[model samples]
Target: MLKLFRSAASIAALILGIAGVFLVLYAWRLPPFTGTVQTTDNAYVRGQVTIISPQLAGYLAEVAVQDFQHVKAGQVLVKIDDRIFEQKLQQAKATLASQQAALANSEQKRRSDEARIASSKAQVDSAKAALTAAEANWKRIEPLLERGVTTQSQADQARASLDQATAALHQADAAEEVARQDLTSTLVNRQSLEAAVQSAEAAVHLAEIDLQNTRIVAPQDGRLGEVGARVGQYVAAGTQLMALVPEKVWVIANFKETQLAGMKVGQPVTFTVDALQHAELTGHIERFSPAAGSEFSVLRADNATGNFTKVAQRVPVRIAIDPNQPLAERLAPGMSVIVSADTSTAASDVPATGTAPGATPPAQVSEQ
Candidate 1:
């Protein structure tokens, strides 16, 4: 009986050992493994942060927002002193009015010139008729004097009358020429007046735009950061006054290059936030970085010219937080997170955000 019990115990021990090995293999995605998951501690919550600035320089007359206040889009945030800008706008309006008046007068003058030209043409016609009569009279007087039918004094008087008529006709022609020139000149001057009016209108528009800039407003719905602006403080254009963090936030997990062999977009991800007492959160893989994180560093590694050692690189993977989850709604940026991805085949997949474009964008560098 003791020998039979020992044989049974040996068989049971062998079976237990085989089961343990199978469980280990399953966790690592080896052959005969039923489950597969990849996890990484190198992850954190991130989101878009908008920096607020001014478009015009002025003394701040009012700071309407308090520090860390939640503001809606188009809400009043800051106010600049608009006394000068208002005056400029009024001045522009007055200038525009004056130009309009000048333009009207020019057009009226042009009309008057046209009428005068017509009168001058009538005078020219009368002068031509008078000139023809004077020439005929002078010819008749000369023939009569030559035939002795008229006296020398009579002929002299007739010649003098003809000369007077000729001078009168010349004067009329000169007056008509002067009128034509005046009409042409008036037409040309009207164009200059039109140009002046357009210029004044542009000035008025610019003044109005500047006045509107005095009242600064929020660009989107977000929570305000530290409000450094104060009433009576003089601020310059493009001065940073505050920051805005939007409500939407997500995470980026940096996984080892070797671990990305079978990872893909739309894979379900599980994460825990360190700030929230390690509260578990779920998401899906949105996209992957085009290159390793080190490639974007300010001082890139140059293995071609120096002693080098190959090291496993980390590639950032974007994860879109499931908006329906309560925890996702409460999550904020800058929180540390531990993320894991299910890399199993033939498993239910999570819906995915679209993949990123193939080309990488240039990194932005700022001094402060």
Candidate 2:
């Protein structure tokens, strides 16, 4: 009975020893999981796509580009029927020429008016000199008639001649005033003609701008898409004809409000595209949405209905890609990607090999 008790004691001791060892091993292997982050697979590669539209309405004469083709900035992509535009331009030029001629004619008329005014002034001076000489003769004859050395009829004749010369001088002065008034009126007319010329010149400038718009060109280096117009198709002003997607790409991550505690601008991020396997990319948190994504939507949730249930909201985080990667002109808009961001690290600690795999250590995470 003592041997049986000893055996049972040994079994109990063995079990206790095993339990202690297991505890020690577990304590050594366990990691400090301060926090567990959640992630989502919903992410995409995006960029600015320029929508090509016409500035003037016309039938398309030719399409100089094809779908999915690469194009450079200022490269002509289409041509509109310029016949009407060219005609309009010619008409404007003709109108401008006519206006210029009218302006020149107005200047010439002003000169003629000045000449008439000068001639009238000269006549007034000549008449004044004649009247002075006749008055001098009459003054001498009146004294002689009173002394009886000159006849009364001769003296009266001299007086009448002086009076006629005075009247002629007055008429010459009035004619001179009339000529000055005419010159002033002509200048006013010239100004009105000058204004008309200015209006015609403005129309000419507009016609020139319209003529330039007949040829369309790409605004930046991008991939062409959605080319809807064809040769001989009449397109109106502001009509969308094609789209150009820029080569540069970025990721738009919709992160929940709770996860944004440490997520700040300039934090590093690692990403993988579903379209391009074996390819990884790196980026930084450029900015966070100012408000929840729903707040910016067309129909925001109304929690004011009184039956309120608390729910986490998401905000869009923009992540700019590192330019050193072998992006190779392959990144396009709306491409699906899996993004993982590291909000714990500083911008300076992040290596330039940001795009390198195995650089950012993955965090202990949960699925969102």
Candidate maximizing lDDT: 1
Regions of model 2 farther than 4 Å from truth? 1-38, 347-368
Clashes of 1: 0
User: Clash totals for all models, in order?
Assistant: 0, 0
* 1-368 per-residue lDDT for model 1 (tens digits): 99999999999999999988987897665676533577888998998789888888999999999998999999989999999999999999999999999989988888888888788888878877877887888899899999999999999988887888788788888888888888899889888988999999999999999998898888889899899999999999999998888888889899987677667667788999988899998988777877889999999878898788989899999888877788787677888999988877432353333443352332531111
Best by TM-score: 2
lDDT of 2 by residue, 1-368 (tens): 99999999999999999888777766543234224333546678889988999999999999999998999999999999999999998999899899889889888888988898899999999999989999999989988999999998999899999999999899999998988888898889888888888988998899988988999999999889968989999999999999999787778888776667666556778888877883778877665556778889998778888788899788777778877787625777898888777767754664342222123433432211
How many clashing pairs does model 2 include? 0
C-alpha positional error of residue 309 in candidate 1 after TM-score superposition, expressed in Å: 1.5
TM-scores for candidates 1 onward, in order: 0.77, 0.82
